[model samples]
Target: MKAKQIRLATRPNGMPTYETFKWTEETVADPAQGEVVLKSLYASVDPYMRGRMNDRKSYVEPYEVGEVIAGGVIAEVVMTNSTQFEVGDIVIGNLGWATHQIAHEDSLRKIDPSKGPLTNHLGILGMPGITAYFGLLDIGKPAAGETVVVSGAAGAVGTVVGQIAKIVGAKVVGIAGTEEKISYLKHELQFDEVVNYKSENFQEELKAACADGVDVYYDNVGGTVSDAVLRLINKYARIPVCGQIALYNLEKPDLGVRVQPNLLVNSALMKGFIVSDYGAHFEEAITDLAKWLKEGKLQSKETVLEGFEKLPEAFLGLFKGDNIGKYLVKIAEPSE
Candidate 1:
């Protein structure tokens, strides 16, 4: 059978264009013993993928030119040789940018569609969800009644981080870029306050919003907004540096905002972490996330694209902050 795949055609300097990728379909032998043929259902588009597009040293290695771009995907087993899974079973794994994947059964984690939407497995219950869980709880360590601030508050990781902080009894304030997103965070998600970073007086507004000062800053966008937030952090405040999407497109890293010296005066704690680094604690985090999700204490959103061919467009949207939540590409319909 043949499978469609998107491969890196060239390394992108800033914002990637369609020319940077080439999509093609190729035939491959059927699954080998202990392997399954999976039909991808959804693919996640994350900020980290931008780093992988460059040939640079990062928490993860960059994707080589002429290679298939990798990412988390939700799929269904259409054929299997392993006793661990059978035909029509749903699963999630790092299946890259292909409509079909052939791999050992162990490479996929069986998922129960009855638990929730299959797409949730790629969003709230997936890597982005896990990142928010550990990044906020382990790194930020918010206390009850303490003021917690989150940048990129409407994005996948940021939304979860802010809501989780509220569940833990912290006064949550969110920073997003649009009026619609700001309204959603305040009215729908119930954040204590929502600030539009694009506003003319964003800095002054942030100060007025957090009258008591911020105890924990869950930073997803690191630029001028973060620089302003840093000025208001309480002594010994914690900053969990989950991402720097604001500067991901910069050709020179030095041109990005500088925030180190502020940490010195406030005696603050700032740390950069990769969610994969806390793999051993994933079960614990997921257990809590699932409970909160079921109990209505947590909420998730996804901006989905209809076909696998739109993957590049969906990915480029991340850098422009055009997506409202977890950006996902639906490659195929899920099995009933």
Candidate 2:
């Protein structure tokens, strides 16, 4: 069968545009004894995938120019030679941007749709949720009644961070760009305080909202936004550096306020981490998240763009802050 794919056309110098991706068609090879043919169902677009576009050394290898761009994907087993899976079984994995492909059984995890929507596997109960769990619980250990501030508080990981913080009894304050997002975070998500970072009085607003000082800072967007939040750290505060979305697209270094003094005066602990850092504890984290979701203690919101061709657009929109909660692209539905 012929499959469509999105590949990295070139290493982006700044913000990646549509031109940065190349779409092509290829014939999928038949499955071998241990493999199965996968029909794409849903694909996830995240801020971290942008980091992979650049040709630099990081936790994960950079995407080669002219190679398929791969990330978390939900797919259905269309043809299988493996006993672990049968045709029409839905699964999730680190798959390519292609509409169809062949993968070994070990590379995929079968999904239990009864637990939640299939899309949730790529959002709340998947990478983003797990990232929020470890980053907040393991690093920014928020105590009851303490102030917890999260930048990029409306995005995939940020939303989860704020919700999980509230679950732990912390007072949650969210920093976002648009008024709509601010409203949603404040009213819908029940955040204690929501500040619009794009407002002229952002610093003033944030200071007022976090008058008691920030005990836990979930830094998803690094840059001026993070600079503002870092200034309000309480003594012995903990900061979990998750994503630097604002700085990811910069062609040159972004020099801002020095943060060492803030850390020094407060004797705070600041650490950077990728979700994979807590891979060993994913099962536990997922169990807790799923339980919260089932009990209505946790809510998930997703912005989905239909069609496989919209993958690049959905991804580029992340830098533009075009989504709230989790952003996903629905490629196809499972036949089963």
Candidate 3:
């Protein structure tokens, strides 16, 4: 059989362009023993993928030029050789930007579409969800009635981070790029306060919204926005540095604003975390998140792109803050 795939054609200097990727079709072999062939249903586009574009040493290796881009995918088994799975079983796995992939039985996890939208397996119910869960609870540690602030609040991880803070009884405030997104955060997500960082008086507005001082600041888009929030953090406050989207595409470090002295004066605690570091708690977090979702305490939003060819476009939008909630690409239909 033949499968269509998107491959990295070159290393991007800053923002990736269409020339950076090349789409090709190739013949795929059938599944061997203990392996299955998956027809992809949904693929995730996340900020972390940007880090993987550059050929540099990091926690995860970068995608080599001329190689397929790696990402989380929801797929259906069309052929299998393992007793653990059968044809027609829907599963989630770390497959790349491809229309079809072959994986070992152990590489896939069964999915229940009845639990929620199957695409969510690549969004809220997936790695981004786990990132928000562990980053907020374990690192931020919001206390009841305390204030929790999140940057990139309209994006996937930030959206869940704010809602989860509210679930823990903390007053939540969100910072997003557009007014429409700010409204979504306030009206749809029910955040206590929402600020449009693009506004002229963002710093003043943030201070007014967080009168008591931020107790927990979920730093997703770290830069000047993070610097401003840091200055207002109360004593012993916690900052979970989940992502630095603002700095991801930059060729050099942003200069002119320094907030380290404020942290020193406030005795605040700031920590960086990778969700994979807390893999031991994945099942526990997912179990609780599923319950919250079922009981109406948690909600997820997804900006889905149809077709596998749009993966690069979906990914490029992340740096521009162009997506609300989780950004995902639906590649195929979920099997019954």
Highest lDDT against the true fold, candidate: 2
Candidate 1 — what's its lDDT? 0.89
Highest TM-score: give the candidate number.
2
Runs with alpha carbons beyond 4 Å of true place in candidate 3: none
Choose 1 or 2, whichever is better by lDDT.
2
Deviation of model 2 at 119, angstroms: 0.7
Worst 10 residues of 3 by lDDT: 251-260
Clashes of each: 0, 0, 0
Candidate 1 or 2, higher TM-score? Answer: 2
Residues 189-218 of candidate 2 have per-residue lDDT tens digits of 999999999999999999999999999999
Model 2 collision count: 0
Q: Write the per-residue lDDT of candidate 1 for residues 110-207, one digit (tens) a residue.
A: 99877888888888888899999999999999999999999999999988998999999999999998888998899999999999998999999999
Residue 135 in model 1: shift from native, Å? Answer: 1.1
Error of 3 at 286 (Å): 0.5
Per residue, candidate 3 scores C-alpha lDDT tens digits across 50-81 of 89888889889999989998888888889888
What residue runs in model 1 are displaced by over 4 Å at the alpha carbon? Answer: 255-258
